[model samples]
Target: MVERRILIIDDEADIREVAQLSLEISNDWEVLTASSGKEGLKMAVAHRPDAILLDVMMPDMDGPTTWENLQQDPTTKDIPVIFLTAKVQAAEQRRYAQLGITAVLTKPFDPLTLADHIVQTLKWV
Candidate 1:
């Protein structure tokens, strides 16, 4: 199977570590992490990863804004993005869905099941 590259953008170090390790081990995928939205944006453009897992809150350029910037960039516009957020309220979910993201994975997620969730959501098998 071809190894998929997943980029994780979050301000939290532990969260990034958990996600990177989980995806790498569970799916044998290449995982890249950025601790800020600005850094993440640069990495996304340079790496052109298969998908991006973005956190909803950050110090600069929150998730929605980051997504908008990504959409505006020709190089990153087509890359799929999945939001990882703690905001799991119904209205919030609806709002996120309206952004046309590939999917949203709530925080406090199971590391063991994260890859599976991504696969099922993205139909990556």
Candidate 2:
């Protein structure tokens, strides 16, 4: 099977690295990471990843803003986005939904289950 591509957008280096490692070790996935929304957008256009895992907050451009920009670009609009954020309030979740996010995964997530969570959320099982 061809490895699925997943783009991770987050300001935290550790989080991005950990997620990349977790998914790579557990499954056949091509992981790409960006440290900022700007970089993420650029990468999204070029790579056309199968899925995007975005952080809610970051310096410069936040996840929502980045998501908006991605959606505006025809090249990446159809790609699914899942918010991997620490902002886990009911209202915050609603806000993510308002942005048309496919799913939201909270911070401090279990590395072992992370890929499964994403698969479940995306209904790829």
* Candidate with the greatest lDDT versus the true structure: 1
Q: What is the lDDT of candidate 1?
A: 0.94
Query: Tell me, what's the RMSD of every candidate?
Result: 0.8, 1.0
Residue-level lDDT tens digits of model 1 in 1-125:
56999999999999999999999998899999999999999999999999999999998699999999999999999999999999899998888889988899999899999999988888886
Model 2, runs deviating above 4 Å: none
| Stretches of candidate 1 exceeding 4 Å from the true structure | none
Residue-pair clashes, model 1: 0
Q: What are the Cα lDDT values of the candidates?
A: 0.94, 0.93
RMSD of 2: 1.0
Instruction: Write one digit per residue (lDDT tens) for candidate 2, span 22-110.
Output: 99999869999999999999999999999999998999999999999999999999999999888799999998898899999999789
lDDT over C-alpha atoms for residue 100 of model 1: 89
- With a 3 Å backbone cut-off (N, CA, C), the pairs that clash in candidate 2 are none
